[model samples]
Target: MEATVASLVEHGWAGTTTTAVAQRAGVSRGAQLHHYPTRAELVIAAVQYIGAARIAEIREQATDLPTGPARTAAVLDMLARVCTGPLFHAALELWTAARTDPDVRAAVVPLEAVIGRESHRLTVELLGADESRPGVREAVQQTLDLIRGLGLADLLTDDGARRRALLADWARHLDARLGS
Candidate 1:
């Protein structure tokens, strides 16, 4: 699965073939085929596998964050890391492929929905933000959307400085709005 995710990140969806994943994973082609009969199946499984691992990492990191204003900064930092990281990049590859490929879309949409929901839940939980509070959920969603957009920009060029500055500014606004 690690090899599959790495392949997707490095090669994009079109280039990430089952044979490539098998080679990267050091497994026989037959063995790989046994587990995943089709490219779509392999890619879907890879996304799910990597998504699960990323979510676990987020949960683990959330446990160590301190409460207060710092928590807001920390949560934003974590979200930024997640959005700009390899897992997200790999998922982006799948999403891009899914735009035109029905098979890929069929496999990816439901899994992507699950990952999106979990990501939102994690962000809300880590911030201790009450979704019931007016505008709280919208604020959180905005934060996520901003981070994801910045992440896409990062994929295009060296935008670290801009991303950091934007995140810092957003963190302040979010802290005030959520009173975290």
Candidate 2:
């Protein structure tokens, strides 16, 4: 799965062949085929696998999060890291592929919906957000969208300094809104 995600990040959707993944993983082509019979299946499964792993990692990290004013900033920082990580890159590749490929789109749309919901839920939990309040839910979703845009921008250039500055501003606004 690591090899598959790495392939997607490095080579993109068109280049991430099962044979290539097998080669990178040091496994036989037959072995790879045994698990994923088609490229769509392989790509979809890889994205799902890596996405789940990344979410698990974020949950584990959330345990030691700081308290008080700094906590919101820390949560934003953690979310930024996640949005820029390999899993997001892999998902981006799949999304690009899905734009023109109906089969891939059929698979990725629901998969992304699930992942996005999970990510949103996790963010709300990590930030101790109360969605019952006015605009709180939209604020959280906007935070994810903003971070995703930053992640997309980072794909071309570093975008780190700018991302940090923007996220800091966002964290302040979010902290006030969420009362975290």
TM-score of each: 0.94, 0.92
Q: Which 10-residue window in model 2 sums to the lowest lDDT?
A: 43-52
Q: What's the lDDT for all of these models?
A: 0.85, 0.86
Score candidate 2 by TM-score against the native. Answer: 0.92
Which window of 10 residues has the lowest lDDT sum in candidate 1? 60-69
Residues 1-180, model 1: lDDT tens digits: 889888988988778888888999999999998998887788778768877877887887677788766778889888788778888898888789889999878887887788789989989988889999889999999988998898899997878888888888888999878865
| Steric clash pairs (candidate 1) | none
Q: Indicate the residue-level lDDT of 75 in model 1.
A: 90
- Give a tens-digit lDDT track for model 2, residues 20-133: 889999999888889888877886787678767777877876888899879999998888887788778887887888899998888778877877889889998888899999
lDDT of 1 at 40: 74
Separate clash counts for every candidate:
0, 0
Q: Which candidate has the highest lDDT of all?
A: 2
For residue 83, give model 1's deviation from the true position in Å: 0.7
